[model samples]
Target: MNDRVNEWTPRTRAVAAGRPSGPGEPLNVPIVPASTFVAGGDFAYAREEGTRTWVALEEAIGALEGGSAITFASGMGAVAAVLDLLPAGAGVAVPTFSYSGTRGLLDHAAKQGRLKVRRIDPSDREGWAAAAGELDLLWLESPTNPTLELIDIASLTGGKARVVVDNTFATPLGQQPLALGADIVVHSATKLIGGHSDLLLGLAVATDETLVAGLRAARTRLGATPGALEAWLALRGLRTLPVRLAEQSRTAALLADRLAGHPAVRRVSYPGQGTMIAFELADADTAEGFCASLSLVVHATSLGGVESLVERRARWAGDAHVPPGLIRFSVGLEDPEDLWRDLNQALG
Candidate 1:
């Protein structure tokens, strides 16, 4: 263990951070799927959790965020844990447009008279700072869900309230919200981390000991622990994250750039760091037809997979931030040439 798990490059840390003490002896950390443990007990029970399934995810993501990490049943589970930080009837400030689940959960809590929720202009630094005084928690997203609006995390975290980032879209690779001073980073492993979309999972990483303890307590009390199999799949997905990210991001950048120049496209919206991209067509009708025309790219809502996907994000709810014609793209390891060709024909 190094004093600075925090000091390594993203590539180095993503692949190498969670080696078993006997590294090289066992290639990957074995999935310890059990409800019980021996008295030698580094870990007591699977429900209570252990180091193997998540220690790797935690250290790897924590090292990247310069914090400690916790694994959860879904990204919203991690969000629920962080939301536990606020007392009953406390105020929370979040973006006008974010993942539907986050907004939906807050709305659900608000309906239940648990918290006061407000949607702020996500890119407005002063708006965040102004609202921070009244807030118990501040939520942020960079290159936001479908619109890809950029927010300076350093600016967002500056105000009084604790800051929580939905880093699922950006992944831990492209964005370091914790390093920029956010209190916690939450991700839905159903996307980029699981790569194949075969598993449902969530994670939280934080430098604050209080938030870490609170997350553990919430997951424990709420019974949101993931099964051993999903954790194992997420672990496997992570090993190739650096490789997957590099290739997919490279392809996405190219695809977005080419699409931007097309007469049918009104705009392109990927920040060029991760595989997620969103573009809008000149007409909403054409955007629908274009998606229908794609052969190589599947028309799917979820992103971050080994195969490319495109979806009409505006068709989904809470699309206030995204343009009505916006089409989200999730780049995969597919051939860049074929992807471009598919886009060309689809747009035509």
Candidate 2:
């Protein structure tokens, strides 16, 4: 690792942070597929110690997030690792509406009496502040999934409990949660960090040495290590994250403005940043129709790819609280005018 990397801009750090530092080394870190390395050195088994590929990915992400990072097999794996940091029967506060996967995990834990769960609206600063002292963890999502709601992260930190922010939607380029007073930041690198939707990976970053060690131990004990190829692919995608996010955010803003003025769209939830937007129609049927009617944009479930995707969020039973007419739209690299034209025709 180069000490000079700390001084560069985020964009430059994204591109330059994880490359081989020695003279005449490869420009990109090659995929090291070894499961075990001969005695000594930093690694023995892949699961317990990790490979150079994973190290490269961690270095890049840690540089961008300003913390030590641990990679996982999937986004939920990262989430679970963070949750594992809490003691047994701990009290945790989460967003009332968030990624269904996370909600499902919390529900399962609550059902098993592993933890006490409290659902709080992301915008309720007072509720979060009040609950901060009693809770063991504050799990938050900014520009939340599907709903695209923003939370005041700084306002809720500095309590007795540890604070973890899901930086998946906002991405490191969009915001630095640690700098905003969060103890940890997590990302589903499977989404925007992978850019092309070709890989699945997750990361948890923390400035605290104890928390970082705990997350690494969790990954080892849970066998949640990411594949060598996936880590390499994520690293490649990260190199372009800054540019990709910039273009997508610009187009999202344009579409959001247009959607807000359209009669067919009753409401538009866009935090005025990031590439995600949630727009409401009259009913579930209308929302489904809007998704089905698109030509260029894809009608699908996951988000954050180079191609646009739209889906009726309420279709999932776990997301029943979401508006039946809400469609979560993920803007991509498509020309803004072409995307708007397709959306316009679809709404008709």
Candidate 3:
């Protein structure tokens, strides 16, 4: 696997996309831990732009997303950069079932008269399509967080608004929103791109270089630059993303089928071919017990790690739209049988 992966398959690209092609360069990207470069030229300060490590990651993600990429300190930072693209009082539409962090930020901004926000239901494809023309921007999260309801990227992108799809859950391998006519694609690289819970990172990719520049400038002004170490680590994780997602998706599909048939599960919301799964129990108490009973799967809030995680969505004060008994399961790289054994015993 080498740096030249443009003509290669996604699997090959995942492992080979951003490697340095110099005669004596290392196979993996090395961390450029400089906060300030030697002055007298551009890249004088890390806060103003970012280091080589960050660029390496951005390039890798850009290749996958079919555009240029920008990295931020965290997922919220990237979200803020995108929102900052809109002028004050501009109109934007977002999914009601999307990530709570982004939703909460939008809600706060709307109340403060920063932006006008309309909540769209991901399952309501027709409504989304109709509202798209009236919006200045359309923010989408297909297979919306918590509940796995998908949205039609192509139909919504055909409208007047500049479409920005949150491609965190689907990742670049699963879906290329940019290719589908979306203006920008964003990811919580802390999740799938990192493929581990070790770092906090976020990314935004766009076919239009101007839009990417705006995000870059916003990140610079906000001082939302990611650390070199985290950037390097994320690049390391990106190499194995294809393989990791394949295995996790496989196990999740298996678990989703079994859980859907179980009497204890009221509903199984799995759109298919992704690691994330959301299912419902009878009530909040039952859901809490289910989480507690799991011995192998950790009871955690974050997802896309090497280990499995399950938590009740309604426990978070922000995501009330999610059912009280709904548990967001993040399937990890574990044996399906072992995970089922833990889940089955926990169900009882």
Arrange candidates by TM-score, descending: 2, 3, 1
- In the range 188-307, model 1's lDDT, one tens digit per residue, is 988998899898889998887987888888888777888778887887888788899989989888888898899888878777688988888866678889999999989987888899
Q: For candidate 3, write residues 59-84 as lDDT tens digits.
A: 77888888999999898999999999
Cα deviation of 17 in candidate 3 (Å)?
1.6
lDDT of 1: 0.82
Best first by lDDT, ranked: 2, 3, 1
Worst 10 residues of 1 by lDDT: 19-28
* 172-244 per-residue lDDT for model 2 (tens digits): 9889999999999999999999989999999999999999999999999888999999999999999999999
- Among these predictions, the greatest TM-score belongs to 2
Better of 2 and 3 by lDDT: 2
Q: For residue 319, what is the lDDT in candidate 2?
A: 95
Worst 10 residues of 3 by lDDT: 1-10
TM of each candidate vs. truth: 0.94, 0.99, 0.97
Clashes of 2: 0
Model 2 C-alpha lDDT versus the unseen true structure: 0.93
